[model samples]
Target: MTGWCRRVRRFVSGRHPPVPSLLFAAAWAYGVTGLFAALDPLAARWRPGGGTAVAAVTVFLDLLLMRALDDVRDLEHDRRFHPERPLPAGAVRVRDLVVLYAAGSSAVIALNAAWSWRAAVLAAQLAYGAAVLAAHRRWRWPPGDRLLVNLLVSLPAPVLLHAYLYAGYLDASGHGAGWSGAVAVVVAVLAAGYTELAKKITRAPRPGEPAATGPLGLNGSVAVALAAPALSAGLLAARSQAPSAWTPAALLAMVIPAVAGCRFLLGRARRPCAAPALHLLLTFAGYAALGLAR
Candidate 1:
């Protein structure tokens, strides 16, 4: 009902303004594990329990934590240019976000420790958080630092998911090719790097000053950048499964969202009315692309 309350809700939970939806990203991440493992020949041996579930839980938490921090870091800047956001509008308590993020991070690592080897993947991803903080504090910059953080963090999500899946397959069926699985996981890392770059160059706002809302900046380009990998990965995944026929359909599925995401990213700021649906679509494209990479 009130302005501040609306902003806070928008920041912490909603689909527009303050940020994209972390919850959606986490749920999509679960799909990354499911699809990769299901397609693996080792899927026969891949059990649902063991460290695999633990890894899934950790990855989900990590997505939430990282996404929250990104908003926290951008609070001041967004408020100046985009006041509808929770931090800028005073709807969400910025100080409280740290505690929330920490709790999630702790829980993720604890679950990861149960799986031992899998924990390494989590730590690798978590380390990127610290790196981002350092870059922000030490360098007083954003998109570049943000890009590095994205690539670093992205590497682990799919790789770890694949690892857990492949690990289970090895344990149960003893049939998985460890090296081949590792290579597929690496492809995911590369795809994330591309997404990071897209986010960096597209629709990007000026770091300190907000640009008048327009379609030419970092964010807009990012909307398109998200397309590159989503398109490629969808085709690859379809090729893996259907080769001739299904591949085109899969590629189409990937492209349609990308086009919709671009449409949203370009139009949402003006419409505000259509923002939630658009942001949700953008988040879906991002997560699906990552999952497709796996």
Candidate 2:
């Protein structure tokens, strides 16, 4: 029992540092959910409810599972390059992480099943995640191509999140976003990809690290980041039923991050990673708040 407890501690502390993880998870939850709220006709106000809270929890768990799996799959690389990380530092073992991943996956399944038929959406998420991990392990995508790699890894997150929310909303409201909803989904997915790219490119790479931004040069990456919100705003404006209160605020929220991204690219900022992460969070939260706000 003691041994198992110790392993759990190491695994949780190493793989899931609470402060940062929870913060990111919170931001991500709100951000993607914002998209759902914006499109939901029944959401007369921008106030999150039981469904939103449930979705947030599920999204957080899914992200946590994916993070653990990535560490497990990239154990060798981490050992070589990121030896201080929990897995590489021997603070946690692969077997322990596997168990953790399995448990987390089970929780996600249970949560989604209880929420509604959203279980299928969660299953699809798991499948995509598995495929991505498999590719990373087998194909060895170019490390220098961090933008594409990050996009491939992170895109499914927003998609699955959207699916989960949509599944519940449709089940409850018996409606869909139709063509406008589809556009919003595409916008959200692209924002997610750009956000992932920004997270990578903003950080000044260590000397021996792979190219930080891949084919997305500093300028290009920042541009994409800035554009994500702009495109979202355009789409929202086109929607007849888009939440009026959230629309402008969300656009402003996106602008804040975009400007910060610009600063990082210009070397005015010392580092790139933190700001972009915050930016992504705000964008999601903006949409979520708008969607739920009465």
Best by TM-score: 2
lDDT score, candidate 2: 0.66
All candidates: TM-score: 0.60, 0.82
Top-lDDT candidate index = 2
Tens-digit per-residue lDDT, 1-294, candidate 2 = 576568768766776777777777766666655566566555554454576667777777887788887787777767767899877887777777777776777788888787546888787787777777667777775343465666656577667767776766555445655554565577667656555655555455666666665566767666776677677667655552554645675565566566676577667533445665565666666666666564
Expressed as tens digits, the lDDT of each residue in 76-122 for candidate 1 is: 66676678765666667665566666666677767756556556656
lDDT of 1: 0.49
Error of 1 at 93 (Å): 4.5
Which window of 10 residues has the lowest lDDT sum in candidate 2? Answer: 237-246
